[model samples]
Target: MYQSKYPQNFPENFLWGGATAANQIEGAWNLDGKGLTTAEVVAKAENRKKMSMDAVNEAVLATAIADQTAINYPKRRGIDFYHHYAEDIKLFAEMGFKVFRFSIAWARIFPNGDDQHPNEAGLKFYDQVLDELEKYQIEPLITLSHYEMPLALTKKYNGWADRRTIAAFTNYTKTVFKRYGKRVKYWLTFNEINTGTWGFHATGALDQDSTKNEQLQLRYQALHHQLIASALATKQLHQLCPMSKMGCMLARMQTYPATPNPVDVQAAQVADQKNLFFTDVQARGEYPNFMNRYFAEHGIKITMHPTDQQILAANPVDFVSFSYYMTTVTQANQDGTAVGNMATGGRNPYLQESAWGWQIDPIGLRITLNEMWDRYQKPLFVVENGLGALDKLVNGKIHDIYRINYLRQHIQQMKEAISDGVHLMGYTMWGPIDLISFSTSEMSKRYGFIYVDQDDQGNGSLRRIRKDSFYWYQKVIDSNGENLI
Candidate 1:
């Protein structure tokens, strides 16, 4: 067990909970008027090298759509959460959860990207979920879009690469805000909006046949549209539900210099800036000067409307949220060979690596919280952070001591960050119940206090088993961050 040097604990009303993406957790992909999503078309990890959105282009999507049974798409059978949410939420309530963060599948609501009306069945499903949460008094933090973009949007408008997607997204947001506004107060515009900087499939769903320069241009253009969409969504939420708060989510990748060399330090700074540019635009409500220089130097011109800047500036997010799994190291002119959290950088020899090669650096969480608080001065939320490992069930019990240790250290650091004067809002760890892995799409690489009986090939009883961490987390929550032992 870890102990904090400071006596200060998490805030009295600090939201302690867990987060899940609809595509990663909710199965029944093609049921109840649900359309296909970008997540549904990507093949499982055994068939692919790594999770690259670039691999999900027009042809690949077409092939996957025509014959869905040819490949065993793991996301299509996501722990059967669509049918098991009540059971899962009951388990969460047993763990003394104060909140739950989940996403609404855009395709589930709209079926097609530009549909005139949302599917009533999809809306009713969430209504049932909210009713359950209300019964348990669990606050909900809902993400509007979470990598499960409607495949039809990619086919017709090439995803967010075209400006028409903005309207589609806004319409979808308006529908949810008007429907769930009275019930849910916290909302996130997108999941890890910065990931779009590297992978177009995650954000834009742009065609992968373009040249490197053309791809970069398309990615930025899509990113611009998303920023505008986020701003518009924020504005609309305020207009519809003045009490609701909107936040921008980022995949926060903290970086350090590989050596004491000045060039290496500068390289690390540049890398950090590239990651922060997305949050800067959302939280600060304007593009930073470094990004302008970057766009000019790289010959990437982002087409924008005359009112886009005004929209963004007038409606900044109420809070800044992000995921913090690991940290990265950087050198001046060397390529990154180490990988973690949808990004690659130099290896940090001081830190230990996870089973999948992600370095574990709990202290980095404190550094990240302090840095973000110093820069934005907005309320911060750590929406995603957890350990994904190979879990073994022995005689109907899961020890999961490693996961317990990982979370204990991270939560201790979060307390340190709070003592350091950061106005932290809450922490919702990545997966409270074992769902599909986003990067590998594997069930074996599990990260949950509650284990679901499933495998990579999609075989199991679909049973839910409480792991050892479940009781430990329950104690922690009951004490409000006072008990970790």
Candidate 2:
């Protein structure tokens, strides 16, 4: 017999889980009394073309009407999790998930953003899903809103650009907290909320046709409302579910200087600050001062109600959560071979790249964990992290070894970070079961241990096939991250 040597693995009480957004996994977009969400308006990307997200964005934001049927909206039909949740949750339990992170579709609950009450059928659908998760003791980490803002709000109230959206959001928040707060303890106010400015469509609110200056104004103004709404939701959640812990989710892409030049270093620092500024407001309970200078420099002024500051200051989050896939580089010049999803950059010469061009640096995960912990001193939850890749279904099975290797390396870095004194919460690999891709709005780019028999053109048997990574991840969780292949 041979004995192996390794460091102490994941904490005994560490959370092991998978994540899916309701807008990304739950089909039945208009089932029951659900109304159209902003996500339903974006058209699918043509997979035949090179992986150019700009082409997808052109079709996505160019048509902003609430009528999803008129356009080819991929998210409108996401793997049908609404109906197949029982089977999906069963699969998750088989892998021994301690928690499952999913977003709540606001439009499903409110139908219209400003509805007087929630749709009963939409509420009941989640109840059934929650019931299934409870059967397996899988705790739910719910995001109040991902990229799912009701289209009605954007059309009627100019999205979050108008402060009234805060009121509507709080109404929806209060309803959900009352309904599901007892069953769910972990909550995130928004998914990648910073995207209101970073990526227009990520918030599903910003209009793409607007002028550059107009986009800048609307983005910042809209962000103010979301920040207020986030704080208000935190306060309301504690009142409704005193046992609950609320978190703020960000799309965190650690940045590096392209060269050792002082100019590049300064640019990277500014970029990093810009990325953390939103989370700082939510987690620290106040807006950062650099934002004021940023607004002035951009020729934008954000108006806020007198109580907005008080609300934010009073309701800081219990934890901070974020998604990290790849890191980017910022330089004095914007010219570069860019790569990635939320944030792009010149290729990291020391690393590999995913088929989608995302630079793969597992060590960046450890660096990010340490930086976040040191800055905020809060327990961090990696609510989203995974490799989006091209997978082949062979012999009625998908042997996704690349996906396995990606995850294994990331987990090793996570273990390293945990050992380095980062107070980590849990890791929920994004899209455990392949669903519609948010980056390109195509199904071909997958990040799942469980394969959903679907295609970019929305053709397949909707079957769930366990990929090779499924068994690998199962063992990792089964051994509490002690077993790594």
Which candidate wins on TM-score? 1
- Cα error, candidate 2, residue 88 (Å): 0.4
lDDT of 2 by residue, 1-485 (tens): 23374445677878899999987889898789888877776667554233322232335454645344623777888998998999999999999999999988998889998888789998998899999999999999999988878878876776787788889999999998888989999999988877777534554454567777878887888888888989989999988889999999998979999899999999889889999998899999998997787888889988878888899999999999999888998888677555655565676788887777778889999999999999899999998889887888888888888888889999999999987878888999998999898866788889999999888767889999999999999999999998887
Error of 2 at 9 (Å): 3.2
- Candidate 1's displacement at residue 102, Å, is 0.5
- Number of clashing pairs per prediction, in order: 0, 0
Worst 10 residues of 2 by lDDT: 48-57
Please name the candidate that would achieve the greatest lDDT relative to the true structure.
1
Please list the C-alpha lDDT of all candidates, in the order they appear: 0.89, 0.84
| lDDT, model 1, position 129 | 96
Q: Deviation in angstroms for 439 in model 1?
A: 0.9
Question: Where does candidate 1 stray beyond 4 Å?
Answer: 1-7, 47-49
Q: Model 2: residues >4 Å from true position, as ranges?
A: 1-8, 47-71, 204-206
lDDT of 1 by residue, 143-200 (tens): 9989899989888898988899999999999999999999998999989998886665
